[model samples]
Every structure is written in C-alpha cells, then in structure tokens.
Target: MPRLVLEARRIALTVQHGLHGRRRAGSGENFWQYRRFIDGEPANRVDWRRSARDDHLYVREREWEAAHTVWIWPDLSPSMDYASRGQAPKRERALIIAFALAELLVKGGERVGMPEMMRPSANRRIAERMAESVVLAPRLPASLPPPFAPSPLSEIVLLGDFWSPASEVAERIELLAASGAQGHLVQIVDPAEETFPFSGRIEFREPESGDRLTVGRAESWRADYDLKLVEHRARIRAAAERLGWSFTVHRTDRPASELLLALHMRMGAGGTASAAPKGGGRAFVSRGPA
Candidate 1:
C-alpha cells in the first residue's frame, strides 16, 4: 500500500479548518456570554441583533481574545542525546514534539516563538519552518533566564530533558508565572533515563561533548541513579506548583500528538480537542505534593 505523505502545512490546515474551527487559538473578541441590558451598561454594549431576535433587551459580555505568544524552548544540552528505547535520540524526540505543538499553536493562529535556541514570533510560518528542523546552539547559554529579545514572554513551553539543576527552572517559572502569563513546562524524557534499564559495565559518554566515563557495574548504580532522577523530577513538579504553572511530563515513546494533547488539556489550549493526557503511561513518578 502506498503511504500517505505527511507535511507540516497539511497538519496546520487540518487544525485550522477542521473540527476545531471556532475554538481555534487566536487573538480577537470571542463570544463569552450575554445578560439583560442594564441602565449603567454602555450603549454599545447592547447586542441589538440578539435583543431583536429574542424580542427582549440583551447585553453582550465578550471575552476579548488575546494572542497567545507561545515559547517552545528546548534544552539542547548533550545529556539529551540518549536514545536507548527508540531509533531517535531523546533530543530528536523532544524536537519532534515541540514542532508538532508549534504547528498546532500556530495553526490556531497563536503567535509561536522558539526564542534563541531558535526564534520567537506570532507567525505560524516561523514555527512550521522549524518543524522537522535541527536545534542549533553553539554552547549552553549561561544558566540565567534567557533574554527574550524585543520583549517579554506571555506564554512559555519549556521542552527538554531539563537535566539542569531544578533550582534554575524553578526561578524561571516563578518569573514567568508572576508575569501573569500562563506557563506550561513540558518535560520530555526518555524511558531509559527514568528507568536506567542498562545492565553490565559500559562506558558512558556525553552525547553532545563526548566526555566518557567507564563504569564497572552499570547495573549496581541503578538504585542510586533512579533515586536522583526521582528527586530531580520531584523538585521540578514542586517548583511548577509553587509558580502556578501547568507541569506535564511526556515520554519520547509516546506520539508527539498525544503530548501536545496532554499540554492542551492543562492550558485549556483550545476546546473539546483539549482533553486529558493520552496513553496514560507513567512518564514521571512525581513524589511529594505538587
């Protein structure tokens, strides 16, 4: 059987004009609700057409639409190169998911940005252009808040292994949330990373830098490694809760579409298409209160 050709443009068209038309993400006045016209209400506030149709006085209450500036930041650290379970590395999986999300957000007409690690903008093309592209970073930027050029952030979606110290992300999230913008911290992880399913002695090498360390008993180190992984994930979850942002964990094994749906559920990104995380797999075993 011939395979169907898949493209970003096709995907965007489906999202923009398909079943998600009215609920598509974009900036404009959206219908909220209506109430009876009141004395103090502005003259223009009265929805005359509706009032005439209903044979009664009515006032329109609209929820002004605000453009969603989506920042899909992916951590390009060497640690993200691990790919034990699948053909693509963890980094590749992260990029694919990011692109799929960018497609959906931009298709809905949200201004999508992939700042420095790439670029940030409200243009769907910028995001679509990045779909299936490579992430290019000369070196890790200083572990400080990335300077969002030309302006500040209204929405942020951090996608990566997030191996950096949890404190850094916590601080960033606080700053982002305090800005009154909805933040979604999407942690892209690999199965091998969480489970440390490796056995026997092997030389571990940094995926980006190529630094290597030969461990005598990789299996014996599993307990300690798993403990630290859990701790790290816990800290991120706690920090997200503190900052009032939605936190989601996506495993590379799952389809990127599912991860996008997972995040949409938390942010109410759109309408009914926005549902709970799919697959229901254990991506992260978060501990403590979050």
Candidate 2:
C-alpha cells in the first residue's frame, strides 16, 4: 500500500511486459509432461483419460515445483544516501532495482529475501514486506555481506556502491562461494562519483566516516582519481571472476530496466546460475554513460 511498493510494482510490471512470459510448465496447476506409465507408479498420478486414448497407461509428471531462493541485500550505509542533482539517491536506486528484481523473481515462482533481514519465501506479500523493511530499517555501516552461512543452492544478489576495499569484498564473496551459492554483484553509483566533476576549492567528505578534506585545487587530482577508480572497480570485477559470479555496474541516472533486463536474461525464469567468464572478463553490462 505504500507509495514505494506501488511505484516499484508499476516499474516492474512495465518491464515485465517487455519480457517473455515465464509460463513454462512448472509445479503450478499447469500441465507439464505426460509419459508412458511405469510399473510401481502411483495411480493418482496416472492420466486415466489420456491412457484410455492409447493402449499404454500414461503418467503425468508436473514440472519441478521447487523454487530457488534469491537472497538480496541493499547497502543502507550512509554512503549509499549520496545523490547528485536531478538523480535519485544511490540508496533509492538500489532499493528500486532490488524491489523490482524481487517482484520479477517472485512472479516467476522464485523465492526472494534479504539475508539476515528476513527469511526467503515465495509468498505473494514478500515484496511488500521487503519494501516496508527498507523504508523503516535503521542505518547500517558500510560493509560487505556478513559471513553468514546461506543455503548452498540459493542465489545471492547484492546491490551497493561496493566502495569498500577489494580485498574485503573478495573475502566475503569467497566465503559465500565456498558454500556453493551463485551470486550477482550490482555496483550502483552516482554520476558524480564516476565523473568527479568538482573544480577548485572543493570540500570532500567521506559519508561513512564523516572525514572531510578540503582541496585547494580539486581539478589537479582528476587524473589520479580516475585511475584509482578504475583500479578499484577492476579489483571488484576480478573478485567476482575468481568465484564464477556475475558483476555489473549501474548508474543511478540510467534506466533501471536495462540492468534488470540483463539480470533476467542471466538468471531469469528457467535460467540457471550463470558461471564466471572462462577468461575472467567482466560480465556483459553497459559501462555507465561516458
């Protein structure tokens, strides 16, 4: 009933229409497959009418009804609250994508939840519960996913700026991958962060630590800053590659549907967990607009 939930559903539905229907035969009330009945089969599963049409008894097998849990986490740290003019806050963008992805996944009969925040469930109200939590949740420190043990077969989707040290990020991911879970890393950023478009006499502050530094000539550090930014992202990509996970960057300024579509293609309905590139190249994604 909240505005955020309503808006997220609208966005999701709009994108959903552009997407292919995930209506393949599954554990639902829909028909899946029929085959010749074998010995010792349960009579309840036999399609008597179909069997009558042929000499052989036919057994109906419903599609695999088991759904995979997709654990999603959005960074609620102070840094995620950053927003340049005319753009949604990084935190808001993360939530929009997270909620939209949850809607899509749940619609496809997959379960979704936030790690440590709630249990995974395919219940129709799951997205609403998640949206409420995000709206009312307390702030958390800027940190990587906690080293909690998760269902080995469940998938993990993390939405954040990932400004943390690469080593820390790699360790957390390695810990999860060791449990045999597939993952997708979505690095959400503001255009300002990428461009560093500040000029002379700028005061920059670290959102998490409240550390501030005044630079007399901000333009002088542009080259070095850009290089460091590239190196930082590369490390994150490399970490994801080492564990066979998918990594992509999304700018708050771009359409959320673009990244959402890519996600659906990679791990949507009937799509298995994607593997890391054989050559360790970054997974397919449009680099944020130049």
Candidate 3:
C-alpha cells in the first residue's frame, strides 16, 4: 500500500512549547528548592489552597513551562530497505513513522528534533528540507553516537533495526532514562530477519556489512539462525525493561499508522490509553517507560 507524506517543518513549530502546540503545564511558578514550608515564608508559596484542607507543610515547586523537545532518529541503514510485504521500503516506512509522530506531537504542541539524520525542530522549513533529503538521497550518518549529551532533558524517538552487535540501541535508551526524559524505540524489521524462511544453496548478504555466506540444504542451519535471532531480540527487550524505555516492534506486514497510534497512546498521547492516570489531583507524567 501507499503512504502519505506530510510536511515536517509545520510540526516543529507547533509543539515547541508543549501541550498541542500551546502551553498546558500547570504553573509558571518559580521553582525553589524543596523546602518544608517555613512558618514565615510567603503565604502564596505555601500552597495554602491545598493547606487548610490537608494540614501538611507543602512546598510549591516553580516549574518553567519550557518547550518540550522530541528527538527522532530514523535508521537509514540498508537493512531498512527491506519490504517483503508491501510497496513502501522499510527505510521509507521509518521516515513515515517519524513524520507521523512529529505531526501528532506537534499537534499537541511538543517540539521535535532529529540528531544526525535531520535537524532540530519540526517546522515548515525543516520539513521541506527533510523532504528534499528524501529525494536527493545522501548516505546516512557514519555511525550513531550516544543519543543524549549533557543537554537539557527532552523526549527521544528512535527508529531503527537495532541490529548492531554492540547493542548501542540499548545503551542509548539507558542514557535517556538516566537523564529523566521519555524514550520510544521503534524497530522496523523485515519478515525474513526472524524466520530464516529460505532454502536451497542461496547466497545471503549482510545488510550492514557486505559479508556473504552460502547455505545449502546440507548446512541449512535454520535452527541456529532462529536461535540467534531470538536471543538478539530478547537482549534488546531485557535492556529496554532495565532502562524503563518504551519499545515497539513493527514488521513491514503492519500498517505504519496503526503502529504509530499504539506508540502515541503509550507515550501519553491520544485517547486509546490515558497517560497513566493522574495521581491525586496533579497529573504525574512518568519519565520512564510506561
């Protein structure tokens, strides 16, 4: 099937502040360090509105409604070009996923940034530039770096095959978790990667590396292939769980939009699933995986 391409730049401009392209965070109060409400501090900071009712010395945290930034990285590795089931290549599918998410997040007023593949912010100009990149087609980044740096904490969206032996995929998620930002991993896979559903003395080519191997009936090695595949996926999942990062697996068989809907809901977007229910009266957004 075919997919629709949306302008990337429009989305970036919208979510820069958060909350559907507008400000929704509770207060612009100045956040002072957590202190027991001293008897003589300003009554306004006492959170007295909640005081007489609860009779607890509650200190108010001044939160700046700074913009919410979402970093999206799409894997352009050759492996992503696999698409056994449909017309869209896995690489294009990855881009579609990134664009759709940026659209939704921008609709919610959340800013979006891409590390090396694309620039920061999902605005009209950036989107147009990204579209141009898609058409002209340059080589991908030589390699991925740890996704997060010593920068302000923000959300991250990773689109990739997660095939590197180093498990750099897992390490990146852990870093993001440590920094107290949300992480979403979208793994785009070709059906063949899992099933080894081939036979005959076929020559196999590695997607990332140009290495080739010929496996014939005498050396089918199907069982071994499946075992390694299972182990690789398991390790990725275990790492995600340990890091508390949200993970989603997408095969070319499924619709990209449907996959996106599930991911967005999990990240506390759309109505399918509400961002883990509010605690007491305050809405608590979980920084780690849900």
**Mind giving the per-residue lDDT tens digits that candidate 2 earns over 1-290?**
36656766777887898676444555655456788878997888789999989999997766445546788888877778888889888777777778888899877767788876777876777668897766566655445776677677778888887777777788888888787788888888777776777789988777766777888998887777766666767777787877778887777777887778778777732223333322222211112211
Q: What is the C-alpha local distance difference test score of each model? A: 0.57, 0.72, 0.56
Per-model TM-score versus the true fold: 0.66, 0.80, 0.66
Compose the digit string of candidate 3's lDDT tens values, residues 8-30.
Answer: 23332333333333325345543
- Residue-pair clashes per candidate, as listed? 2, 0, 16
Candidate 1 C-alpha error for residue 228, in Å? 1.4
Candidate 1 Cα errors over 4 Å, as ranges: 1-67, 117-124, 131-153, 208-210, 268-290
lDDT of 1: 0.57
Sort by lDDT, top down from the best:
2, 1, 3
Q: In terms of TM-score, which candidate is stronger, 1 or 2?
A: 2
How many steric clashes does model 1 contain? 2
